[model samples]
Target: MINSTQVSYFILVAYFDTGALKYLYFMIVMSLYMLIVGANLLLIVVICLNRSLHEPMYLFLCSLFVNELYGSTGLFPFLLLQILSDIHTVSAPFCYLQIFCVHFYGSVQFFTLGVMSYDRYLAICHPLQYHIRMTSSKVAILTAFIWLYSVLATVVMMSLSVPLQRCGNTIEKVYCDNYSIVKLACSDTTVSNIFGLVYIFTVIFGLVILILYTYMRILKVCFSGSKQTRQKAVSTCTPHLASLLSFAFGSFFEIVQGRFNMSRVPIMFRIFLSLYWLTCQPLFTPVLYGLNMSKIRIISKILYLGRRM
Candidate 1:
């Protein structure tokens, strides 16, 4: 058995022979990737270029769109290449890097969403002081914290994982995950596994609580406040609620897949489950936000129509 040092590459066992359909799959994936990039990038550019969109909410959204690009770029390009290639093997170093990017994407997603929730809470619950609390500098600091925190966490996870001695080099999924890599280790992983659980709970559950609490408070205000306030809350918070639900769906399946034995599930379905968040969330968020947020929708329409500035 080849240990990690000797294992130059990892065989992705999930990919099967699609024969003539490989091209079809490639085309489908490539199109989705392009659409994701275009949609997210459009919103990012719109937010950055237009002075009207320089508010706290739009700024948070800009950070989000940028992350969608970051996450999708990490997965989609590698996926497109794998779809077309006969061999689904990834270099060991590349596998670790993919692990980092995918994890980093998720970490940032949850953290950003948590912050977005707080932003909404401020807007709805304390509209009078929303600007006072979420000043431009504060938004910049929060945005920086989101990325920086995710980086430090991902880096720590990667550092622990990279030194492990692998007993095998086969990963059962189309992509590499830290857990899957840990399962292959020939060395002791007690410390790694423990840290992994702590890391996951600290990030996931903690942020989940924050999101839940923020929305709860926001809801309380909407109920007791004026009609206009209720309308404002609904219009502003609907997209965020949808986004959280969408991500929760993907995240649930991901957790189930990662922690449980899922051989009874259909292979195609399982594959879809794995790809749900990485593919669907990235594609879903921009579309959801773009269509739902009127200001963004109008600007996007204007840009698409080539209207004069």
Candidate 2:
């Protein structure tokens, strides 16, 4: 089934048929990328500079922002460059790296969302034990584990892609998503497809279930608390909930699109889907962080005043 004479590089046909629309597309995407980068960077700076934000939630918010920043870089920048330059070709090694980074950061997003859920669960369910359970060293270890496991999971997905030689050179989307790339394999991908399905269902789906269950319990605990405590708990949980909702829903849409045997989906729809997935995590994290942290609000006020002065 393996062929040695197959293509070594894939020509991504992403957004090529747009004719005059390509320029408009580039302008829109570049603007969104700038907004994402700027928002995430601002949040990171605020969290780092504000001593009052030295807490568990803000710490995880920082990690989420970092992951989103790296993740977006792993994807959007190269694609944006290519789109602008009208270059669609990608080398095999670079293609593999693209797949690795996509899945790696995708896995990290799921894991970080799960961590955020657990953080909220602890804060709402056991307010007194929250600090003790989520201690600085413990948070460090959990963050380390998120990075480690993300790499391992990405390794599994990436390792499965290397040996499959490319017969055709056309990739449908901006980035080299595993399933899309694997479909072009000259060899059998039955095993790799199965492995990917299992990973998605068990690792990614499992994380989603855990997050939902944790949040449900958190909501129960909050409702059972005193009025003031309940209000405070609701306020604390809102940002995490918003992030989880966006991540989960956007991911669900992507997975559904991937699984469905339909090529008839509009190119514009595909483009928007890619744009949403790339932009939402990076952009929303900062908004959620600023809303959740009083220190960030205070810092923003001080900056505004300083600018005026």
Candidate 3:
């Protein structure tokens, strides 16, 4: 029986045995990674430099962009290295680190979205009190709480897994996840599994429910209001909803893929599904927000034209 202390590395068996196409796979992943970084950084930079965007909403968006970068960085660099190398092994410490970062990204993301939804709710439903309700200090505190809460949650999850007696060093995924790591434990993982499920439901589903309730209220207020008010509400809320749905789809698919036997699914499709959230959400967010938000679009145009000049 092997223990956690004896395990030095985990072999990842999720890569495609692409034979001659490995180079192609590498190039594709590299390209996507570059795009994700570039898009996210651009959003972050634009938000930072533009004085007009230094509000609670843009500040939250900046945090979201940064989270996207953090999440992708945790996975992409390691994945790229694995693609070029023959060995798919990751050191246990690094695996746990990756687990922390990826999960932190997810938790922070949902929390940030929840904050954004609440921001919208206040701005739309309680227009007169919006400024007082979402003051800069309050927003800053909320953002800090989002990050710190995520870190605490991830730390607890990782700490729970560290004491388990690991029997195997093989993970069947391209990246490290808590579930995959816990599944390798030799001893009973009932506590970890139960806690994990409860954590997921309480965090992810709780945020989802909060978002739904907030949006529902916003919708109700929009319907009872005037034409211009409806347009304003829709314009402001569309990007948030789009981002929410995009993330939800990716998360849902990844969870389903992880929990079920996907043997019948085509290998390429399976791979895509597994990585869809990490790859797509980071790219989807900036593009959706930059294009949909009029102020952001205008600022982006100015930046583009300035670079051209």
**Best TM-score among the predictions, by candidate number:** 1
Q: Each model's TM-score?
A: 0.96, 0.91, 0.95
- What range of 10 consecutive residues in model 2 has the weakest lDDT sum? 1-10
> For model 1, where is the 10-residue window of minimal lDDT?
300-309
- The TM-score between candidate 2 and the true structure equals 0.91
Candidate 1: regions farther than 4 A off: 307-309
lDDT of 1 by residue, 1-309 (tens): 656689899999989999999999999999999999998999999999899999999998988888889999999999989999999999988998899999999888888888999999988888799899999999999999999989999999888888898888888899998888888888988888888789768877888889989998988998899999999999889888888888889989988898799889988999999999888888988888888888998888888788655
lDDT per residue, candidate 2, 1-309, as tens digits?
334235577777755666777788789778878888888887788778878877878888888899899888887788667876756788877888888887788788878879888888888788899889999898889889999988987787777777776677677777777777777778878788888789878877788788879978877876777898788877887887887788777877777766775468787787667656667878777887687767788887786697899
Give the distance in Å from residue 241's predicted Cα in candidate 3 to where it truly belongs.
0.7
What C-alpha lDDT do the candidate models reach, one value each? 0.89, 0.79, 0.89
For residue 206, model 2's alpha carbon misses the true position, in angstroms, by 3.0
Query: By lDDT, is 1 or 2 better?
Result: 1
Model 3 RMSD to the real structure?
A: 1.4
